[model samples]
Every structure is written in C-alpha cells, then in structure tokens.
Target: MKIFSLVIVLIILFILVGVFVKRRSIKIRRIKKEFSVSNEKSIMESIFHKNFLFFEHLNNTFKEKLLTDSYVLSKLINIDGVGIQITDEIKYTIFGLVGLLILGDENPDYFPNLTSVVVYPKMYISDQRGQNKSVNLGESWNFGVVVLSWCDVINGTQNFSDGHNVALHEFAHQLDQQSGQADGIPVNLNNDYYTWKNTFDKEYNNLLREMENAEHDSIDFYGATNKAEFFAVCTETFFEKSAVMKSEHPELYDLLVRYYRIDPMKIFSN
Candidate 1:
C-alpha cells in the first residue's frame, strides 16, 4: 500500500511539472508573437513623437527598434496608476524610457525580474523604511517592482537636457540590483570590472568632495549619497547632458558608451 501511494504521488508531481512547463511555453510563444507584430507602429510613433523629444532625434532604424522594444515592454510589464487613469500614452512613455535604457544591448532581457510599475499622480509619502516618513519622487524595490511619480516622469521627458529624471533614476537602481545587490556594479562588465570599480570609486569620492565644498558640478550632488545612487545619477547625466559629460569626463563617458553600447552624443548631436 505504501509503495502504491508513493507511485501515485510521483505521478501527480510529474503531471504538475508537465502542466507548468506547457503553460510557460505557451506564454513565451505569445510574447514572441506580440513582439514580432508591428500593427501598432503608427499609434506608438505618434505617442513617441508627442512625448519623447529623443524619439525624433533617432535615426529610422533606431526609432523602429525603440518602438518595437517599447511595445514589448508595455505588453510584458503591468503598469498600474494610483489616483490616476492609466492611458496608452502613459504606458508607452514609461516603457519607452525603459526601452531606451536597454536599446544598445543585442539581446535585451527587458528587465526579466521587473514585473510591475506603480505610478502615483505625484510624489508620495512612504514609511516603508520604518519610523521615518519621507516624501519620494520614485522608488525601486529590489524584488520585481518599481514606483514612480507621474508628474516627475513628465517633467523628465519635457527637458532632455536636464539631468533630473525620476524614471531613469529609479530604473537605474533596478539595473544595479540585478546582480542580487544594489551596489554600484552591474553584471556583464566585459572584463572591465577593476576599471569600473576604480573609476566609480574615484568619481564618487570627487562628488563627495564637491558636495562638501559647495562647488558647482555637472553631475548632481545627490550622487554623493552612496555608490548606488551615484551610478543612477551618473546614468541620468550621461543621457541628458551627454555633450557636457563627454567633454568634461571623457573616461567616464567612454565607460558608459561601452557599457550601454550606444552614444547619446550621436542622437543629441543633430
């Protein structure tokens, strides 16, 4: 009787495993189909042109890829608006920024660990870190979630030259957390880990010194908070103030170009 019970349990387990595999396979196929379909190009292009200044600057090939990537991300990630109506424009705009971040990668995983984005109408109060209440423009949780302020996002999109972008800032934290920790380092360093660490440490210390002396800097002073925050702030400056960063910090600019595999200077040059 015990032998028979064990056999039955094994059979049930096998059946459950098979069912899970089949469902996952079906989901993957649907995602691939959705990604390949280009029926929404006109609508997406309109949204991009209206909201994202960077879109018009991109070449035709880059624009098409960006749209396609944005579409896939829109479909994959669940975006929920709090105290606000979720619209196609909002979805595309948010995902378009994400798409831009990974645009240079040959095989973008599309932030596999990120499942959902929660957007508030504006900055929100949070007590998640215990007793202290804080107002935040955005937050990126290490476990499959990101939160953003819609107003801040819009502001970030409006002025491409400004280094303040909540979406880019928070999403950058998400990238930094991909290595199972929210350190300044991310994965796929391309064998430049030592250089990356040395450069980031040196730059982070420099930012700290600048903050202490109350000196003006192209990079934001907020980056002095920590290595992770510094990376995020650097990402914002890299894309928005590409010309200034390139001219001022060529080594850092070159490092970013290699890591991102795209130069914002090319897009912003025209």
Candidate 2:
C-alpha cells in the first residue's frame, strides 16, 4: 500500500510540473505570435476563452478598439493582482499610455518600478506634512503608487486633443521616477542626456524668460515652474497637440519623437 501511494504522489507531481511547463510555453508562443501579426481579434478571441476578466467586462468608452504590441498587451493583462479597480475605460487609457511608452522601444518595461494604481471617484486632497499640500487631480509616488481622479480621466479622454491629462501627467512622473527624483530625465535613453538636457533646458528657459515679463503664447505656463513639471507638461502636449508642439517647439518635438518613438504630428496629418 505504501509503495502504491508513493507512485500515485509521484504521478501527481509530474502532472503538475507538466501543466506548469505547458502553460509557460504557451504563454511564450502567444507573446511571439502577438508581435509578428496585426490580427488583434485573434488575440481577443484567445482572451475570451479561459481568461481572467480584469473586470466583469469593460464598458465601452466609445474609443474604437485600439490595439497595441503583443508584449505591451501582456504587460497590461499581467496587472491582475495590482490591487486597483481598473474599469474598462481606465484599462483602455492605461493601455494607451503603455502603448506610448513602448512606441519608442519594443520593450514595455516603462515604469517598471510602479506596482499600484489607485483611482478615486473625484479629485483628492493631499495632507502630507512634507509636501506642498494641495488638492490635485493626480499624484505619482516614487515608492510605487499613482493616484488619479476619475472625473478628470473622463474629461481628458473626451478631449484627446487637449494638452491636459491627469493620468498621463502622473505616468510621465513615474517614468521620471525610474531614474530617481522627478527631475524630468528618464533612465536608459537611447541617446545621451546632453541632447535631452539641451533641448529641454532651452524650452524651459524660454518659458521662464517669457514669464519674466509676460507669459508665452505657447506651451503651458505651469511648465515654467521646474524642469520636472516642464517635462510632464511637455509629454502632455506631445501626445495631445503634436502638430502644434511640432510647429511651436520643433527641437523639443524632435527629441520627444526620438524618445517616445511616436509621431503625433503624423497622427493629425493622416
């Protein structure tokens, strides 16, 4: 009886090992398939069967079915146990940001350190004793959490052309934080820091110089406050107002184009 029991246990262990290996192999193959093909519907079909629904079902945000790279889609789906109620619309927005991050590079490890995404129903006030202590639509923590207002999110989505998105702003900070301190410089750039600094410094100084007498007619005035904030605001304008930004700040626009691997100008042109 003891010998028979041992054999059964070994069989079960082997079965478990086989199952794990098979699933891992399948995941790898699917990810590869996702990258080489533009057939997003096939991927969706795969998700529909034997998949974890991040929510009961995402409510349509009227934003047409958007598709992203396979690796990016995996990262989006992998946020399963992230401890946040990311609805369908929020997921789409998150996917959009993820797609933007990966647009520059094939890798999707943008904001790799971030783990939590807390979405509030409305704007939340910060009472942290150390910080400036102001009511904000969104906040990004270096430790790992990003807080956002749902109302602002809806508004931002509705006006995709507007250079204002709370989530996008905070996520830009998260990208900045990957290096340490939200000083606007991102880690692991394909180009040297001098290029980033020069263009950013020129634009930032221009904003400040304009503010000395009167505000400039272009970009956001708030960006003049600091380099970090300037980068975040620029990122907003980069995606939302590509054509305007390109025409207004061609150098800055070119730098963003290289870094993000996206061309909002092309978007509007098309």
Candidate 3:
C-alpha cells in the first residue's frame, strides 16, 4: 500500500510541473506578441495602409517615425470600444485610430493605461444631478475607465478650425494620471516640476485674466474653467495650431513639447 501511494504522489507532482511549465511558455509568447517593437519595413507598410488616414495630416518625419512603426500601430488597435457604449458608426472606428495617433508620441505604455474606454453618441450629460447634460464632454473616472463623446470629438477634429479636441483633451487627463495623479501634469518626461508649476501658474493666471476680459480670440472658453481644463485646452492648440501656440506662448509650448516628447509644431508645419 505504501509503495503504491508513493508512486501516485510522484505522478501528481510530475503533472503539476508540466502544467506550470506550459503556462509559463504561454505567458512568454503573449508578452512577446503584445510588446514586440515593429521593424522599419513593417512601419513603412503600415504608413501606406488605407486605414491610417491621419498619417496624411502629419509631417513626413513624424509620419515615418510614428505611422510606420508597428508598436505604435498596435497601441492604436488596442483602443477598441470595449466596456463602454458606442454609437454604431464608422466614425468611431476611425476616431479610435486618430485619437491613438494624436497621442502616439506619448509612448505605447501611456496610451491605453486605462482598462477600458467608454464612448457615447454625443456630448454626454453630466452625472451631476440637476445638470442640463447627462454626460460630461470627457472624463477619466477613479475607476480605470475613460469616457468620451463622439459628437464632441468629431467637432473638435473637423473644426480644426478651432483648437479643442474633446478626445485629446480627455485622454490627456489619462496621461496625467499615468504617474498616479492628474495634478495637471504627467511624469517620465524630462521636466522640472517646480519650473513647470511656476510657468503654468503664470500662464494660467494670464489666460484666466484674458478669458475674463474676453481678450483671447481662438480656442474654447471652457479651457479657462480650471487648471486641468487649461492643460487640455493647451494640448488641443499644441497639436492643432502649433504655430500659433509656439508664437504666442513659447514657454508653454516648449513645456508641452517636452511633456509629449514630440514637437507637433514641426509635424504640422510640414
């Protein structure tokens, strides 16, 4: 009886080892597939793909560096309509890709840090009871979810006539949360927080004064709502009207370039 029991125990141990080994192997393969960097040829091919229409709007160098890169494309693909309601339209698919590209320079790790994206048909009414709108324009909840409205996103993009992308504006909040806080700033970028704070306060105050006096011409009035909104609004101008932002607010523009690690002004200028 003792001998038989010992043999059975050995067999069970062997099975457990095999199972562990198999699971480890599968994990390794998935990691490789998910994080693999795209080679030059792969990136070049992706740039020419019909789906990547946003590439045409970017400068050639940025186009080549970001669009041609497979790692970048993978991040874009990850922005699926998961865990959130969305309107049944082709634009959502296209906007998902465009939003990713707009934020591509932030590095893949920063793009989809949130577990899911919650999309709505239009500017959602704010949950705040008694509010007129049921969803807010864009918001990143305490839970790992980011919400956006398609109508606001489309208007922000098509109206490049103005500097306000609700999608970019909201996603910027997610980036700011990457370092564990959304104090109107993101980490991993080579910036002096002290200096950033000082400069941001000065500019923010000036903008607030401008907003009060109704002096500024472009961008949305909502930006003056608060510091967080200021950052989002400036991000819109940074990507959409880099030239104007660079010329008008050189310090702020420089800080934004450092934060995003990409000079969008140069990209748009090209």
Using lDDT as the measure, which candidate wins? 1
Ranking by lDDT: 1, 2, 3
Expressed as tens digits, the lDDT of each residue in 1-270 for candidate 2 is 999999999999999989966775566457656655756544443432222121113223211222334244444343331234655455545555544545546544535577666676777777655888788888888886777777786677667677887767888888888898889897776556899988888889998888887965457888888988998899888887877888889989889888876676664343
lDDT of 3 at 225: 84
Off by over 4 Å in 2: 1-66, 69-85
lDDT of 2: 0.66
Higher-TM-score candidate among 1 and 2? 1
User: If candidate 2 were superposed on the true structure by all CA atoms, what would the RMSD be?
Assistant: 11.4
Comparing 1 with 3 on lDDT, the higher-scoring candidate is 1
lDDT score of residue 6 within candidate 2:
100
**What residue runs in model 1 are displaced by over 4 Å at the alpha carbon?**
1-32, 35-38, 129-131
Q: Residue pairs in steric clash, candidate 3?
A: 43-68, 124-135, 125-133, 125-134, 125-135, 126-133, 126-134, 126-135
Tens digit of per-residue lDDT, candidate 1, span 166-224: 89998888888988988989767868889999999988898899899999888998999
Model 3 TM-score relative to the real fold = 0.67
Number of the top-ranking candidate, with TM-score as the measure? 1
